[model samples]
Structure formats: structure tokens, C-alpha cells
Target: MEWLNKDVTIYDLINDHYRLSLWGLRCINIEKTWGLCDEKKLSEVIVGLIDSGVEAEHEDLNGNVIEGYNFIHNSRDTCDEFGHGTNVAGVIAAKKNNGVGIAGVADGVKIVPLKVVNKNGKAHIMDVVRAIYWAIENNVHIINLSMGVEVISSDEMNLVRLAHINALKVAISKAIENSIIIISSAGNNGEDSIDFPASLNSVIAVGSVGVHKVNDTFILEKSEFNNSGKKDIIYAPGEDIYTTFINNTYSHTKGTSIAAGFVTGIVAYMKLIDPKLNQEKAKELIFKSAHIISNHKEEIPFINADNIMISMWREKVNK
Candidate 1:
């Protein structure tokens, strides 16, 4: 509560951003609803925030951040102008129980902000490609991409406008070759398909789930804009999740973008438990720990971050 910026009045700090973020914490079991992970260990993972930059000086995130790049403006200032990147990073690694704001899903991991999306919320495909490579070169353990563009094939790499999409294919493939875990948002179109990168085989496509109360039965329904398919898709709480915002503030936003951040946190925490964990093994643990939201009506498998640690313990005891 001390570091909360003076600009963010004490009342606003508790009412706006921090208080309502409990959905994400509960979904990930940061509160230990299942009586797990008592120690709250610090993780060694370095997560890449590849979006609209971040407010590196924010009270909740300043300490855990590393020097980042701004591919959009080609500068050293990675401060967020659009607020989305800070929000995503806050979901992934905002310091826990900091008194001023809500905790992130995986605390203790470093965040490397890569400014790909611009203040206008428009990002060139080439900018995104360069940011991914920059993050890879910096040796970040995981790259969380919450944005995507239409697919472009190798044959169409010279459309001037569509060229970057093709180049991104190679960039993404190289990142995977180096064994970096890439987690992306399932396209927010309310269709059965995701966009490129997310639809590709190499990345974990994340979809959003909304906590809905209908007719006295609680239902974890898909976000209205969530895109779904069998392509490595995972669902997490995303609808109107509260997160850090620019100007030392907070707000609630919706879509698969928020869901992707939670999944990235899960990956980071998994790596912390087992330093040798790779992209393939992490995916396995996540899928194995997922729970079916509604088997009788909806078959969406929602992630239970609390269960992964429990599963690991059960196996250890059985041995």
C-alpha cells in the first residue's frame, strides 16, 4: 500500500484494479483453494511481454523487470502507451501481496517487455517478428504473444504489406527450435478457428472463459469472442479480468488476450518447479491437469493451475 503512486488515490487503489483481480487468483489457485503450494516459491523464469510495451516503473512491477526494447519506435523507452502490455505483464508477474495491487499468477519471474503493438493498438507484423527475435536473443524462457494476424504462406512473402507474416513463420520456428515456449491468444473472433501462430502446431493457443451464474448453477462459459478448435487450445478465466493499467491505474478488459497471460504464468511456474522442463513437457503437464468445465453441456477443458502442483506431489508420493 505504501508504493501505490500518489496519483492513484488510496480509495481507487483498492476499488479499481486490485480488489477485482481475485478471479484470476482463484482460477490459478494463488489463494490455495486446493490446499497446495504452501511455500509460494520464487521462480527463475524470464517471461517476455511481447505486446504494446509496459509501464516499467509501476509500483507492482518495477523491481522484477529487465531492460526491454521498443521495436515500434526503435527506442529504449518501453513504457506502455496503450496499457495492454502492462495489463498482460501484471497478470503474469505482478509482485504478490504487494499491498498496493493484485498479485500476478507467477511471482518472482522476471519480465522482459517487448513493444510490438503501438499506442494505437496497431502492430505491424514485421515489428512483432523483430520483437520475438529480440526476446529470444535475450534468452527469455517464455514469450507471451497476445496478438496475431492473418496467415500468410511462403509464396506470398512479397506482398509488401503481407511480407512480415511469412517472415514471422521462420522467426517462430526458430524460437521453437531453441526450445522457447510460445503461448498465444486464440483469435477473439467468435468462430471455431484461431489465427496464425496460435493455429500453428508450435504454440499453445489459449481461449477465454467467463464465470457465469445462470439459473442457480454456476457455469464457466466461453467468452463471447473466444475462438475454439482442437489445435492445442486451452481455456482460462478472461472475461473482464482486472489488471494493471497505464498512468499508475487499473481496468478490466475481456478476450483471449487475458487468457493467454494466465497460461503464460502457468508455464513460468512449471519451469520454476522443474528447471529442466521444456516446451513439450510443460504442455503435457498443462493438458493432463485441465478439468472439463461442463461435461454434460459444454466440453471445454478449463485449466486448474492448482491441480498441477498437486499432481506432481501425488506422483512423487506414489514412487
Candidate 2:
């Protein structure tokens, strides 16, 4: 919610926007990362970007996007309407160094776009559940969820209602059982809290942070809209981050949504380094290689993809 330039500032990072986007990638250390996995294995490593939709035909994303389903309209195509999914997708894997827009954290990986939300940016738990099952069936290595309940409630509800929420949780568990990493936004409400699926135990909840304009500093300070709480796991630069948008343009947006995308990208990078990486090991490496923010009462760490890649690459050599 730290929407400094809500209207104008929150535009796409296209038309040579990579120059402005270098900071976030540099912070994560993905600015210069170009790791490699086996071509055959890389082709099989699909990363699911679940949200409203994706502009799959966009110049930067078209090549890597594989067959994706639209649970919203029950269609085979997953073109974006609300623009969130496409933005998130670009952040995670927007065809790197294409002499166009910015590069995603895991530019080389294939993306599986799952359109769960409609044009209004709304998605039901049922569709979300279905999307997870779809991603699992398609053998996705990672599932990035940038949408979820605004808040979770403890009040007792009807059996049918509770069952729906439970069903989504169950799908998350099944994904974990399959060794798939599930990453979600911690919400952008700037509270000591987490949204529904993000609050779930198996999901890696990512919070948002703002980068100092001049000093280039880092901290786990919650964005005005970024939800926080004991359930928080990782923090990433989310405010006014530049990324791909609809119509092959670029824009800047804020929220834990983008933060979740950053972590998703990091997780994908970890997998690229080791195709057999499990959820726990991927999380461990991300947490261990992050920028530990001290003096912040809570011990949540911020992701530093650069350090992570260096350590991982070194380990790869020793192995």
C-alpha cells in the first residue's frame, strides 16, 4: 500500500524499463544470474503462475509459456484481463535479455499460467483449489499464488463453507506431499496478519518492503499495504516494482503480490540449480542466503538472490 505514485508510478517496466528495475534484481542478486540446468530437465521444470490471468502473447512471455488452463472461464487459453498474473509472471520469468523489457528472476524456466481470478481480480476458493490440482497434475515444480482471502476467520461456519476452505488447504498439502514449493503473498494490508492460504503452514508467506530511493538500503519494514504477523516468512522489495503488463507494455505496481513473485522467482532459481530440490531444501537455501534484518522485533529475513546463487553455484561445483 506504499503507493507513492499510485496512478503514474504504478506503470509497467517496459520500453527499456529494465534500467529502473535493476535494483530489485540486484537486491535479490538476480541482476547478473544466469544459471543453467539440463535442457531436457529444464523443459520439464514448469512454474505455475496462478492469479487473474497472463498476457501470454506478450513478446517477452510468449516463448516460455506452455499450455495453461483458465479456470475462470473454463477455457484452454489463459490470457490475462486484470493484469496481476501477467505482472507477477514477468517478475518471476520474463524472458531475460530479450532486448526488450525486463528479465524475470528465472527467465529460462517454462511458465504454466493458471487463470483463477476473473477480470475483476476476484477468485473463489473452489477455483483456487482446482487450479492447484491442475498444476500438480501438469507436474509443476513451483506454484506462485499472488491472490488469497483478504483475511482468515476463526468463527465457526457451516459444514459446506468450512469444507471449501479445508479443500483448498488439502490441495496445498497434496502439492507439498508431491515436493512442490507453494509461495503466496502475505497480503498487502500492513498488519500483523496473514491471509487464508498464506496463513497455511505449508505455504511460504512473503511480505513486502520498500527500497530507499537514494541510499539503496534494505529492511523488512511492512509496506503500507503489506500484511504482516507471526506467520510471515520472507520479505522482498515489492513497492512500485517494475514488471511486464498487458499489451506488451511495462508498469510498476505495489503489494505483497510482487513480493511473492520475487520469492517465487528465487525458488525457481534454486530449482534450476538442482532439479531434484525439495520444498524444505529450497526454503532453507532461500532463508539462509537472505539479508537478515536486525532490530526489527520479528526475525523475518529478506531475500538476497545474488548471495543465494553464489553459494549454490559454489556448492554445485563441490558436488
Query: How much is 259 displaced in model 1, in angstroms?
Result: 0.7
The TM-scores, one per candidate, come to 0.86, 0.86
Over 172-206, each residue of candidate 1 has an lDDT whose tens digit, in order, gives 98888777889999888887678777988778889
What lDDT, from 0 to 1, does candidate 1 have?
0.76
How does model 1 score by TM-score? 0.86
Off by over 4 Å in 2: 1-17, 35-42, 213-220, 295-299, 314-319
Worst 10 residues of 1 by lDDT: 1-10
Per-residue lDDT of candidate 2, residues 148-202 (tens digit): 7755464756677788988998999999888899998888766677887888866
> In candidate 1, how many Å is residue 308 off?
1.6
**Candidates' C-alpha lDDT:** 0.76, 0.77
Compute the lDDT of residue 291 as modeled in candidate 1: 76
Q: How good is model 2 by TM-score?
A: 0.86
Considering every candidate listed, which one attains the maximal lDDT? 2
